[model samples]
Structures are given as C-alpha cells and as structure tokens.
Target: MRLGRVFSVIAVCFFVSACSWFGGDEKRLPDIPEQQLYDEAITALEQQEYETAVEKLQMLEARYPFGRYSEQAQLELIFAYHKNFEPEAARAAADRFIRLHPSHENIDYAYYLKGLTAFEQDQSMFQRFLPIDIDQRDPGAARSSFESFSTLINRYPDSSYAPDAQKRMLFLKNRLASYEVHVANYYMKRGAYIAAANRGRYVVENLKETPATPDALAVMYQAYELLGEQQLAQSARDVLLANYPNYPLKSYKVKNTSLLETATFGLFGSESEADDPPRPTTEDKQGLEKPENEAQKEQETKRPWYHKATFGIFE
Candidate 1:
C-alpha cells in the first residue's frame, strides 16, 4: 500500500509537469503585464545571463504566443541564443517567429535574424588546401539568408534596417557568384570542358541580369574554345558580344577593335569633307588677302591706296 501511494505521487508530479509545458498553469507566469515580462527578459539578456533570459522569454512566448509581447519575446530569445553563440538555437527561434507571424510588422527582422544565424554558422571542410570550396559551405542555408535579406529589402524599403539589409544582400550576391566561379574554374582546370561550360552557362543564363554574368560568359567562351567545339565557342562568343562587348576576350579584342573602327569612321561620316585641302586660287599665289570688312577697311585706310590695291589683287 505504501509503494502504491509513492507511485501515485510520481504520476501526479509528471502530470503537473506536462500540463505546465502546455500552459495549463497560468500562475507560473508573472503577475505584471506582458511588456514587463519582456523588459525583465531584456534585462537578463543585457546582463549576458542567456539561460535566464531564455527561460523568461520562453515563458512569455509560450504563455503569450499571440499576445502583445509575443514577437518581442521571440526576437529577444533569438538574440539571447545568438549572444550565447548557439546559432542553431537562434535560427530555430527565428524560424518559429517567421512561421507564426508571416504578416507581422517585424517579420523582416525575423528574416534578418534567420539569415544572420546561417551566415554565422557557415564553415567548410576544405579549409586547409583550398581556401574556397567549389561548393559553398552551406548553400541551402546561404540561399535562405539571401532570400531573407532580399525579402527584407523588397518589403521594407524605407525601414531603418533597409540600408544594412541592402549591403548584406550585395555581399550575399557576390558570394553566390563567387561560388559559381569557383566551380566553373575548378572544372576548367581539371580539363572537364563540358562541366565547365555547363557551370559557366548556368551563371550566364540564370544570373545574366547580374554584373557577374559577363565574366561567366567569358569563361564559358574560353572553355568552349579549348574543347575545340567550334559551334559552342561561336555561341558563347555571340553571348559575349551581345551582353559584354567591352570585355577583353581574344575573339572580342579584334571584333571590338573593328567595331570601334567602324563606329568611329562610319558615324563620324567620311573624312573627305574635313581632309580635303582648300582649292588653290590666286590667293595661293600670293599671301591670302583679308575680305574688306569694317575692321579691314579701317586697317587698309591706314595703308597707302596703291599698297591696298596690290594686296586686293588676290581678292
């Protein structure tokens, strides 16, 4: 009978703990308004008490997931996780916030935090030999970061965070392009011409609107040329000519010089009118005589009439 009573107590305790987790006990929450709980969480976070902050913030999130302080609590929890160097935890918190509040005002901030978490967690296995990997550290995560930052800009163009978000987006764009270039260059160096050409073509076709497209197309041109694929080389050359005429490639070098020559000579019109020597007349036999304008008349009046008549012989 005593053992049965002890087992009953343990069962009650387990039930209470399970109930508490699902918000069955309202008294576990602070008596103050939700904002005050958030304020307390922030204070804990400021003191670098990450565990305490997470506890307080998680309570707020659980008890008031849709309350006025829910978003604030969620963001604070993410910050606390990040400050504690637990990026995966931080990302989880951020993801929950985004999924729950898809249309919230601070949704951009949620996305930003998610991106920051992924960026922070980025690392590669081939850190010793090749500083850059042909494949990115975490492309899926990096892509998520890109998407988040892009969405932040598109949605909150006028937000104060917009400027920082814009700069980060540019960095992500360049990094993504760098990864593609790394793969293409790797394939080219390995003599895998088809793979190199395909990788380069991906960048040119999909990211053609970006500044890196020209470089990508040029690399594809080189790959095609080396592989002895005359038709592919010509197609790549056409792409280079169409999109990046100013790029200095072997094919484009002469092509562009000829273009410059054509444009300079053709658009400037024929040099015949400008280069023709003046027709020879009596004026060429003697010094050229000035026309008899008012100023010339005044000057000529100061000279003798015979001298003026002699000068006027050419006129």
Candidate 2:
C-alpha cells in the first residue's frame, strides 16, 4: 500500500509540472491593430527606439500589406533602416519603393536617400573627425553614391535635393580622381612605367578640372620618360604646364641597386659607392597660347556646377 501511494504521488507531481509549462506558453497578448502598430512605430522612431521601430514597422507591413498606411510605412521603413546603420537594407528598400512607385510625388526623396545611404556606408567613425584621405580607400561606395546622385539630378533637376546631390557628386568625382592618382603613384614606385602612364592618361582624359589632374600629368610625364617615349613625355609635360604653370616637377631616376641589395640596406656595394650620381636638372617648359576657337574655348571653360555654386569652396 505504501508502494502504491509513492507511485501515485510521483505521477501527480509530473502532471502538475507539465501543466505549468504548457499553461505559461498558452497566455499571449492579442495582436495589435494595424493603425495602432503604425502609430507605435512612429512613436518608437520619435523616441529614438530604432530597433523597436523596425520590429513594429515590419509587423505592420506583414499584417496589412494592402492597408492605407502600407505605402507610408515602406518609406518610413527605409529611414528606420538608415538610422539603424543598415545601409544595404536602406538602399534595397529605397530601390523597391522607386520601382513600385515610379510616378510617386516623393520619388526624388527616395533617390536622394539611396545616394545618401551609399555615401555613408564607407565612412567609419574614425574618418569623421580624422584628417584622413577618403580617396585613398576603396572607391566602390563613392562610385555608387555618385551614380545615384547623378540619376536624381538628371531625373529631377528642380528637386529640393538636387543642390545637395550636386555638391556630393563633385566631392565623389574629386575623390575618384585622387584615387587614380594614388594608383598611378603606386605603379611608379613599383617601376611599372606603362601601367603608371596608362593610369595617368586615364585621369587626364576622364577626370578634368580636379586638383589631382596636375599630379596625374606629372606622373604621365615621368613614366613615359622612364619608358624612353620622349614625344609622349613632352606632350604630357606641355599639358601640365599649360594647365598649371606654377606646378613643380621632380626629376625621376632609375635606381641601380638590385632588389636583394635594396632589401639588405645596401650591404653589398661597389668601391665607387662613396661617389653619388649627379642629380638630373629640370628646365621650365613654356606653355602654348590658348586656342581662340569658340568650340575649344567652350570646352576649356566648362566647369562642374559645384565649382560655380560654391565659388571654388570644396568640402
């Protein structure tokens, strides 16, 4: 009888524990109404609760895909993603909105936000306050940002965001030009004269009116000279002098030291090492007179809009 009582007590304890576990999970809050959910999301955004806002916005979209607040919710969702530092998601959302509502009145804003998202993606916390050269880094994000801004400006010239977009495009252009110059410099250091010259030529042909143009021309001149192409070098030099008369040119010389010797810090040297080679001298080259043809003059006079807008001030 005692044995039967013990088994019954154990069975009752197991049943009670199972009931408590299942009972707790059975109680759940009712689903919020669609309007209430959107309101809560907006409130969360206003209160700087970005994660909460994202959750609420997502729930609203899923619950009421055809509701009146659906369109506005999608737009707000893009902003919430941006604030939460999800640039890729923000860009995707913006693209989706644009595709779905091509004729939407606020389409320009979507384009602007897409560009802004790309612009902020590559910028790190250290870059904000540091005197860092953004151009020296990867140009992928900058290029994407530039294209997005260009699209906005071209599609909606009178957009409220056009001016800001124009400014950012100029900055990206200069950054891309600077990046080309950096690559050319690296090629020059490695003695890849042809590759360096090609990079310099690319800059001259594509990135006109930027600060890095003069340096690019110099690189082309040096690289061509190293490759024994006197005519090409002179052409590059003439263009540099014509555009920037005051820019200085540094003489280029081929180092005679072997790679092993250079790596070993000149440990293996000839008896005549004490005598330094004569440094090459640079002569000033005069620039040709400007062309008087109207077409040529117009081409030369064409400048970026930001140049005129900012009166030569750059960010």
lDDT of 2: 0.86
Worst 10 residues of 2 by lDDT: 268-277
N/CA/C clash count, model 2: 0
State each model's CA lDDT, in order: 0.73, 0.86
Best by lDDT: 2
89-166: candidate 2 lDDT, tens digit per residue: 999999999999899888898899889998888677879999987867998988899999999999999999999999
Off by over 4 Å in 1: 1-36, 63-68, 123-140, 208-215, 226-229, 238-315
Tell me the TM-score of each prediction against the true structure. 0.58, 0.74
| Location of the lowest summed lDDT over 10 successive residues in candidate 1 | 268-277
In model 1, the Cα lDDT at residue 73 comes to 80
